[model samples]
Target chain A: MNSSLITTKTQRHKEKHYEVSAPSVTQWWSWFKDHHEDTKSTKKNDMSSDGNNFRSALVIGYGNTLRGDDAAGVRVAEELARRHPALRCLSVHQLTPELAHDIAEVDRVFFVDADAMADHVYAESVEQTPARSVRSHSLSPTSLLSLARDLYGHAPRQAHVIGIPAREFDLSEDLSPAARTGVAEAVECVGAMLERS
Target chain B: MTKTITISPVTRIEGHAKITIALQPNGDVAETRFHVNEFRGFEKFTEGRLMWEMPGITSRICGICPASHLVTSAKAGDDILAVEVPETAEKLRRMLTLAQWLQSHALSFFHLSSPDFLLGFDSDPATRNVFGLIGHDKELALKGIRLRKFGQEVIEILGGRKIHTPWTVPGGVRDPLTAENRDRMLAWIPEARQTVGIALETIKKVHAKYKNEITEFGNFRSLFVGLVSKDGALEYYDGFLRIMDGNGNTIADKLDPKKFEEYFGEAVESWSWLKFPYFKQFGYPDGMYRVGPLARVNICDFIETPEAEEERKVFKKLSGNVGVVNNSFYYHYARCIEMLFAVEKIEQLLNDPAILGTTIRSQASINRTEGVGFCEAPRGVLFHRYKVNKDGVIQQANLIIATAQNNIAMNRTVHQIAAHFIDGKKGKITEGMLNRVEAGIRCYDPCLSCSTHALGQMPLHVELFDANGSLLDSVTRS
Candidate 1:
């Protein structure tokens, strides 16, 4: 691990309380803040009234809408974007190799996508370090980051996987009850992550 | 009355076909037609879709060479957008396209066309298959299939979706390649080279035994058209086109295929839905041209790699330099050479660090205009022209597919093969002769699916009438 990761390990031990100090990649997190601000119009808006300040957090949700419960992530992204004015939101469905290079350059990134059901549960997020799992997509987040580092030498500072356990991946355009619940919870969880960031 | 032979289920190909042969009661030549029996409506279904979605959507039309159509359509959209893409993007597309050629042509030549060459043309029909091929020579069968699969794997890895590539798009590609992926692709090269070496050995054996089949199966003269580098190198992925005569003399060079309207024309036959493309200067069957392996072999002055160069040397030595080869059957030789060339090319393209660079796609805005996309499909030259509105919706599209481009020539070559090789004795006019004629067509690897359709029957048909409009006799399949 790098010095920042080591420093965070020590800080967590000393505090003994669950307090994430945000991404220490200063140039990177500040980048998110600057761009998130730059993209907005010059106006002083009350953040507490706007569903609390989203601040410098970037929330991304991706999945296909017509793919049954597989659309959970996108639905969550859509809701989050509406709720938090400060949250930078993007909902990409069909990712391709063509997008790999650019996607891997973020200081901190969160991917919200649909996945095959886990233990047949509604949804689950991997809370710790990611294990090497083969992505259903050739241009999965890990592979894309590998590509960025290999081809472009610019891997993002942080990436977290928010996988919504999906019940169906059929060709239908409707969402199941379980999938709907997963999306709501995912939105809530992402709202929490944004507050921490 | 005329008699006919109909094979309603033509198997062992990507799709289905029904072939009918017509002959007179007394066994006189009448008319011959290759009929297409199945239809998949890709064009009608793809309408109203985001024009950028065409590449992936159109690819599903055929599983055999989906990448060809995918790349062609993607380029079409890109061209219409009037965006000047980055060089890296163009090169990456070409590299992917060449990979498609390597796999598709390998499938066409070694998998589909090999049984005829390996087994005797007169071999029992039931035994003329991959099983039979394995029984004849197990190692050759294994080697060929493995090589084909490797090509498929490479495409799948790079494009994300292999059979239906969703990665290509308007401004360039949607993503870029990394050093890790490039290294993975490069690892396959040396083995690919060895596989070609084995294939070349098989080529020599097959050619030696089937000398007459090689030389006279489809012996006829026609104009040949193919894509070659501006520098006259054999380039399948990107290049201006050159049309050469039977004697290998250049009729046209650096001809903007987009301006094909100026030099090329198509005629429709009453019997076949496929359009017969011909040179405007020559007209109809007279202006007919052959493409794919035969044309590629004829047009280019140089082969890029050492293995392909050596094979070219042997080809030129067997047939005298450029002008000596005229038989359609010799296309097998050209196919082998191209396969070798593709293997070498993959290594060269992937090794460039630029291939693994950050700019796989250009970060430019897109506009709308009329544009044409041209690339050499494994079977032949494929052209896609599109006109997009200011809002970037497709206004109109015209596609001249590789198989459609060879319709007139396929008919003429079939006629020539039947005339030259079939014996006068009716009993000796064997299945071998028909298969030989079909094999010649197979050499071009015509995708009748890409062409509009074929009417029916596969034999000479003739109707006799007196000068005074008196009907004498009607002849069908013999």
Candidate 2:
């Protein structure tokens, strides 16, 4: 397959770099500034906040968009943006240490990923489980929380793994039938969870 | 009876590999071999794909250094289209390459090798890792992680993703650097530079303590090969191939990448699936040479960056300013110097106005039936050659991976260390000895994923056998 011909959401997103004059540019600029500026440190104890204080949530949707059905996480993340536009969402290939600082300041974190082993979509609470040793490229949600705790002295107050059951992993752009259904379920589940939060 | 002691799947490396040391009946090391045991036919799968897909597809070869493959394959695409990459694209490519160097070298030093030095080689394996380094010194460990994060962040900003970024195409990159992203990248340089400075100083102090390791580990005389600028300075993105002798003599210079077949040859060995690449002039094992940080430092005339330039001087003075430093243990020191240079280079590129230019690609059609591209990967020099049909469909592909290029040198180094540390006596086969043997290979930081290009996981298992071929003991790390 001509992978170059297969334009991914990432490629399309990058192509948007040239269209900076678009109407949404100002909105994106604001979002970028608010999310990125002065985010280098998040050392405040997220769990120590008063029960009545507002809690900020970080929603990370990670998957390879090029692989069939593997893009479910990214799809759910994109859908979450539409359903809950005010939420902080990051679309990535995987969880990395750089996200630790971001995770540290947030009171809640939702890690959305595609799981081939899962028979159905599900959401479960995830606890900090720091790796004995770390590979910079291979951090998981638990590891990122652990890293936040280790480096920043605190992790998010609550973290949940939102898993979308995936059936196909081959090199293709189309999601599987079950995965398409799973994406909707994941989006609804995440939307409900965000509402309850 | 001769006894064999094996250390399987040297831990904390990018991929799996093992080392076997044979002990003679009289309690002296007899032989040693470095084994790569996995096969992923990446080349075979590439046959019939559109040539433009290579940069994207081949980037999957190794997660650690996928940027290297992506950049190198794109260069090959450049050759096929016969179009000069725009100045902005070149700058971006250089910046990306350096970022990769920064992250990859940091990994080798802090995560893989530092634990052995800081925690002591004889320390418990469980604690002798990056975590141990963190427990022993939190600031240093955190600095290492942040330094790596800086590189990965730069990559993500430029390519839109960390691993398997399809941003790099045949003629140029997919997107140009925005002024915002440029400033964003520039913002990270000061801290990145400071971290590398800290690491360099720490390694120098650590190096001073490892007198025996420096003297005995993988110290041998062989040739060195790497890319050098026209003026014989350090060049990683693009340069002429230069070869230097182990004792610091220039053997050959300005060998064209297109003409590599004339001076490079690959020899297949029955025991290892990885091809043993050697200098054609010297032939087989005799032409064996080392690459990666050690070879880059050895073969380069000078580092252009200021801090690294000064570090180079110290390195030269320490090693008599010779053309090559035969000791592989110095690879750690060389890695630090390169990381410093990469950080400096990144800052330089980010400041360049052309980096903000939007004209990153040069549109072109198929202009050549075959093309070859070569670049210095984080591990060493990597070459990718492709033959395409008139319609741009790849007919055949050949990848000369860096680790395979260092196979002969790694095997010889394994033998050298095995002989230095091993004896037939039971006590000689201590964990420290095993570590030193593994340390010899670690000097190369061999990425078996890139070398073997294999499917499935390959865990390390070291086996000890008597002359009669009976298993005496084995240690397997999964």
Candidate 3:
């Protein structure tokens, strides 16, 4: 019969503050990093052939995994981590300037997430990613790349983003028929990235 | 030489809030400020809109739990109209709120909070995510997914869409619940029960394993606020305002929901657009309190709903229930107990059968007036007070978000957690300490995006200070 469900107090601004919780969750429990760090190490291993290669890849996913297809970016990063142990991957609910480190030292980066364009007609395929499908902030790949450049140095030679068109991004498990299909298609895109490297 | 700790682009949490902790040479917390680098202006943007448009527009603030915002906003509109909502409308609204609470809470605990508790806070950060948790505890992951799905199912059946539905309007709901939707929810009852069972078992096991966390983690205490039955029973969906002290006595009660301004006041921060809402009587900063499940349970005597009350008794046995849950870390435990409340409330509402009746929503419109609406949102108390012109266009709006209520209390709670956990510890600050701190904040489940919208290039700075306010270290979020 027991039930459970799930604060900041008001305060004045003080001096310098660093996030105390960042170290714990970010250091040991980084799934994207675990999945991609192996590849980064492998890429480092490949660096034995080209020790000077500054190329690195970062993939960040945004959207809720609990609700069917909104978890596109997270799913791809998880899958990428599983298949390729050497690529650097960072998965997050949304993009932030704090993520610049993940984007740093990488030659090319690809970001994935569910696209929510206010004007985008919910058309069915990857074949139709018009500017209309481009949504507002919650982290955008282009904006993140710009931030990375501003913080870390130069932009990577190649930077791109892959988006999944969501039809019914409800709290439901059942994805709109179209979004369900994007999952496989997205996996293939990651696989192609893996092969390209 | 400098020492720096960074978790670039933090992962595995809802919203874009991130933590960056830099320590001093002595390894003390130099300065700590939880940062929400993302700018979302739902509050400001919604201005000049019609009162009825709020439920739809503001629901867009949070994609994860729009239903709660939708319902709360609608309730505010109802207050403005001063029309009594049909009983069917009220019951349906309760069901939707409970349903969303179940889904949102599951996402936070099982998917977001579980990694630290289950995989060990010190586990390799790379693999300590939901994906890793999935491989480590596949059954648990599946149950979490299923449980959230059930809640979403309830939302979808009633609202037509889970993310942002227009089913709820100003006077009442847009339409009545159909037999088909009602039956669909009924069919999922068995699975829902099973999922709750899994959650109860897993949390209990977690409690046994990390009893220290439940007790010693983030021991900050403050006034707890929530809605409660006049009899002091826990009531989330609809009830009068209640604020209880540490001694569990009501400091403020039966305050008209519309007259919240008389009891509460808002203050602004130069650093962030988020406002700090404090108790008017107690004054600012010091008057800070926390809401959400832990606070809700702390303030109420018993849950009026049958099964929820029984669950409360058992939850109380865990570290004395609300009595034992003085620390913020226990918020996670308290959250699971709330899941039980949501489940129980849903069952009670559904069986009424009249909940599925033909009459739903009131049909009334306010010409223009100043009105206040209060509802115990899943997070805690959400107060939406608006002033509109003759045409029902909003002239001014004030929202006392549940997170803002705990603003000052959260900062103090951080101090509490840090002081207790790190007392006399040798060597460098361990990752566990960091996790514990984040866990404490997680207890309140602050949704920064929904909290405020400050724009125009935020300065990225997080500093940890010692007791005397000496800067230990500073890190920019950007």
Candidate 4:
């Protein structure tokens, strides 16, 4: 939704396929650092800051694994678990209400999901949204954060969404080549974010 | 002049559905139809796949009740293999099934339907949700979330993942219950029990408050169908098919699930993708029966657990002389009772020493060309039938989904609520009135995704049209 923060592109494969170029790790880190500082300066009361240090972090990567590139989020979480065993990572089909408790216990949280309409992987800070009607079984990341604050009276000091660009969402377990590449980039970006935190 | 009120993409349920209410010249409801709009050809597409891959593949049919599909598919595979699953494996499978029931029912009650009861049905559509529940009673909301999480945790411990785990296999489960995981499950029992108990009390108050709505919301005399143990006790995992009439008479007992097609028939409607399943003896609409929590509690003679059995006694009294609770709104009440039973049953299963046994799976080649597996899913009775070749490649697959089994009844429920709430003469409808109609469908907690095997976005759009088919009034909610 934030066009300025997102960089979109179009690419052609065997068939003309629209693609989003992934932001380099350095560019992503720079954006995140600036956004982090902006949040601290603008909303001091909102962040339970421990002098810019987060004690614990949780990564919830959720999407339908059975769907094609929709599995990008879960694949990223699974890869993160395999690569960084010490990190607390959960790969679920969708975000449900119970995840609020998990989110409340952490100082920082990253919600990774596949962005079907996006051309490239993008990360943005998340803010708690007012709860509207729950139209479906699944909850959005902002809604989950709201639930965490409303039900548990505790929310992560920092929350962000790392969306992997995904196109194919048909009934298949394999990710698209573009999505696979996006997953790699997203994972590296999240890993760097974790290190910086 | 005739009028039609269409509610598209019915909200708060698992999948995409629409309800159309036809109003007669006198402003009376003429007919109501619940139309499931999406279709996933799981039955047809499953052909040519090896029998062993079914549990994993069919499990993907729904995120809400994947465990039910997983377990039922495995049972079908077991029949193809013609090998009796190990005793420990059966116990583990039972635990997983109960866990599925707990979580799925909790979601249906607390997250989906509770807003209608806890907050008045006429409350603001924006605030009438789980979020509203959190604002109104934070502790209750927390308990509901934790209760559902407890069920998912038990499932994760058994199947290795919360959703769509392929741990249950053809002969048995893929893993045994380790003591460590068993301990984790045991630690959750007390809180889970307390939450269910609290929910039960809350539903009782809701029942008392909405006495008039209860009788009008799918309150009809049709046959109730579910699986009952050999001794006529409540059963979920494996049992004989039991069909009880509205008068509480057992019309059919000890029916073999393998011969489900002979006794049960599926009728198709041009309007909806969901099939209407009926009792073959009664035929078509006359044979209309309800399944799911309302039907399950009605058909079962007794529950094995102590606390749940006590609640079942009070639940039965709601039917008065008829001896069956026909009011579908009581589906919420029955769901709470079942959750209590699931928690107690989970504890009982955990305490069983044989549950920890190591011999989980049995290996075997194809022994039969056809197999049928039936179980009581969280929604209702789920049947998976498969036909295979000598090499065990699937040739045909037919699934009798629980939601589809209640198609006729859901339509009837929509009609009943529409007639009671909406007035065609006024040419106007309130949001509360429309919500009551949708709430009737929610009683069944119909999983359109599992029934139709298709998942899509859900939003509510209501359109009112005159006999000439010109739009008169419309309301949209997304």
Candidate 5:
């Protein structure tokens, strides 16, 4: 909304995008380019190549791995890493306020969680809300986005929650068949989104 | 007829609890109770698990201080194996514990209790929180955030993630300290030291203004308990148990934690899920003792670092150097000093040459069927005990958390505050009176989750009971 930067507003848009000429954005873009170049040179001698150049994205996958099928989010994150080697992914037990710092550095974020109440893999766009002080062990993804915007001075340009339906959350290590199927669908959906970007 | 008042699910603390105040026929306060509403059968659930999995499993008891559980469980495992952990691993664990102390204490002092001191107790309840503190002093609020972040950052560097990192294991830790982590932690020391220094100074100055409140707010004589080094210096990671009388006399020194059952007794009441732990020497209610920062400061002969040592001297002077401080409100001061000591200790550990050694773990099999582990958790001294079969599967488990240990003392403090603040004949309680009652419990920073861990969104409820044991009035907060 600042007058110094170019902005666009649209009516039929389910997604919001901004074109920025801010010096900070320019600096971050150059830094990412340099980092990508360094990564390419470092892996120059590797035999097998992961060809996809991941765009600026932050994927946060959180769930208790100790609880069966609840690890679906982490599993999808692992799958995404294999398919898009350069993507930034964080696997956590829960989302904490500290992650707001990381969220500020990216242009896009995806919060993946196992939804026991869901029927199938689902994805929804997350818009930042006014940040409020939370008095709990963890914060919701939207709350984290709000925190990043209010406290850290920058929020991700886009964010979404990729929910994978989970069938079991008992004391077992292996995922349920339903959760496995859901993870596959989730992987395809999230992977396609990244590819299109 | 007598009447009772209830304050349900005390807010701004970890976990859920309610306070019940009973009044006599003449409208005089008779009894006050702090009831823990949730309980998790952790001991029963861990019965069939392998002893080695305890460090990870038990760490889930409380998300706020999982490192304490992890370290204590690992130590219990050490006792089972009967093997001494390597020196480097011990140093690394010490660093981890100190980091936990920093974060936990910061949360208690700055986020939880600071509002009571900063914003007057009579301030609007809606605004009496960390956000309120932010409105009053943005710099201080930001400083607290960064301070907590620094502590969590250290934990992340040591283990892998901040919460519930399975870095520590039996006989030692699984990872060695790296030069990068060491340097990063050291760089944070100066700023941390500055922030705590300012906090200490601010607390001391403000404490003088609340003299009347301090004297009347849960200020009573009770036994104090904590861990102390061999020379009776403050020790958090490993030390001998030291118990002191209200007047600064030693009740017991160098008590072995394995023999804790002999000196400590846990009593349960029908009204609450939390156990009331008391010193065995006096029996039941008479042996009630306070723990956490107040107990640690009172039990220690001296602090290690010069800066904290100076604060200790000031603290003692305030308490008339009687070797014990009876006032519960001084918890804020003691917490600040301990945080200073923790930072200093962290800096010292990081500079130790052996800290970065690769010899982090020692391997050993179960040598004992029964074992005990003890450490001074951020709240107070915590004990983990387990009895295992020959195959290394746990047969029984017992955990004495810091909050549970201070349960009796917390209850007594509530009674004391209610007696002083609540005027039964007035037939009405002011919001400030309720705030005072809640403040008394906050002094201990009781984590109901650590004491009686549970899940479910239970709305906070407070019910009043008459002398005939019937409900008179009730209040619920969501």
Candidate 6:
């Protein structure tokens, strides 16, 4: 099978383009400034106002893009970012400790990741897991929430793990058929959750 | 019966690895080995790709220090193109390199190693982590996180994203630094400075507290290697190579980084996937030397930044007239000092108006078939060498990563800590003792991801085997 046929949207974005100009520093600064202000205002609203209306949401989709099927989470995040320009989305290789700061500032957060053991797309509430002396390169969603509350004294009132079923994880930019379907389902599920919230 | 104890997938480091200790019939420590079991084959797979694509592809080798690979790989491309990047491009690359040093060092000191210092080494396994540090000192934890974030933001300001940025290309960077972005980075200087200050003071307290660990944790005579400025000041972006003996003598100096292969040799062992790098003159095993923060600090004659220079004075005193700090445990101290220097250097670079110049790249085709790029990664010196055809497709690639260079030292460290903490006579090892062994490895901050081109998740699993190779006991932590 041709690898390009199975390439995910995320991989297309990552394709080598030597002629493409780098993003403008000025434009990025403007966006960053606006995002900072939005975060502060949303945080204040979450603290003072009734928790029901004007809630801010953050979607963190993390996995290895080069690994087949592991790119599902990032593909879902790219789709969400395209569909809802107002929503804040982050696609990362892995979850790290610094992510807690983002998790603490929002009212709700969805941690999207590819799960090798899962059979289908699903979302489950994430509980704070007790700290353990594990590797620091990557963190589980539960441990990250625990870190948010412990360090910043704040965690999203609602947190969840959106697991996209994955099988192949070989060194390739393509996604498995199952993962491609899972990405779509996960994106729809997260969109519905964001709207209801 | 004799037995073997294995600590697989060592925790708090960048990649997957294990340590095995063989015991004599009397239960005395006989031999120890550090094994890197996983392999991603980046060197092998990168072949046949265009030289221009290398900067992006190689940067994915390790998530913890992608910028290091990105910058070094770009330097290799510069060599192939035979073009001197514009002045502004050089400065921009320097800024990005320092930002990476700041963030990577912060991650090493605060998130990974601090728990061992702030919380007791004997602390419960479930609570001896960054989360535990937060419960103990919220202010410190927040400062660490923010400091790291500040560095990441600088990278984002320069490149488009925080991780895996392809903004750096062959011959030069993709963009110039804008005034607004430069000012935003400058605003972070004060807090970054303060956090590094507090961290330095805290590490001193840790040094005073663990006097025994200071002496026994990988403390021995070995050569130290790193990059040094023309006048022998601390350097990260670019410089010639320098190798210093453990007794504070400069054995080799003013050697071109491009000729690194002439001085250093890589030796492979059957038990591990990671190669052992040694000084050529001294030979293998016996030629073993240390790299990274400890080596960088020992090698340079001085640091240009005022605050860091002052700390370097204090750091040198740790050697007490011998001149070179040999203890692997002091890697944390050296790392904090380097962070201070990185912040100071970043501020200086940002103040230069030349950083805003428009001429950032020099376009060229493959003028050279083989090119070697070398730079000081956060951990230590990193080299990226490539051989390409006239059409620019890579024929061969070699990556001498910092972690692989310290492989022999890490194994020695594991043995030293194991021997000191574990009394084989008792025939049992406590979790604390095991953690101390891991802590010794953490001092080097080995990124097996870079060393082995790592794959898969790393969870620590220690197993014990009797003389007949029968499993006696085991412990696993996820």
By summed lDDT, the worst window of 10 consecutive residues in model 1 chain B runs over B450-459
Model 4: colliding residue pairs: A20-A119, A20-A120
Q: Which lDDT tens digits does candidate 1 get at residues B347-466?
A: 887877677666665543346567677788788888777766666566566677787777776666655555565432252335575566567667667665422111111233333333
* Docking quality (DockQ) of candidate 6: 0.23
User: Model 6 misses residue B130 by how many Å?
Assistant: 1.2
Query: In model 2, where do residues sit more than 4 Å from their true spots?
Result: A1-131, A134-145, A157-197, B427-430, B450-462, B467-471, B474-478
Residue-level lDDT of model 6, residues B121-206, one tens digit each, is 99887778887887788788889989989888988888877457578888899988888888899899999989999999999999
Using lDDT, rank the candidates from best to worst. 4, 6, 5, 2, 1, 3
lDDT (Cα, 0-100) at B335 in candidate 1: 80
Q: Give the better candidate number (4 or 5) by DockQ.
A: 4
Q: What shift in Å separates residue A86 of candidate 6 from its native position after superposition?
A: 1.3
The deviation in Å at residue A101 for candidate 5 is 3.2
Q: Candidate 6: TM-score? A: 0.89
Best by DockQ: 4
Task: Give the per-residue lDDT of model 1 (tens digit) for A113-155.
Answer: 7756332112222233321221111134554454334344456
What does the lDDT come to for candidate 2?
Answer: 0.77
In terms of docking quality, model 2 is incorrect
Candidate 1 global lDDT: 0.62
Compared with the true structure, all predictions reach lDDT values of: 0.62, 0.77, 0.61, 0.83, 0.77, 0.81
Q: Regarding lDDT, does 2 or 6 come out ahead?
A: 6
DockQ of each: 0.02, 0.10, 0.03, 0.31, 0.11, 0.23
- When summed lDDT is taken over every stretch of 10 residues in candidate 3 chain B, the lowest stretch is B451-460
lDDT of 3 by residue, B209-320 (tens): 8767666665655677778877877877677878876555578886666677887778776644457778888888767777888887777788866766776777666545
Compute the lDDT of residue B248 as modeled in candidate 5.
Answer: 88
Residue A178, candidate 4: C-alpha displacement in angstroms: 4.1
Q: Model 2: what is its DockQ? A: 0.10
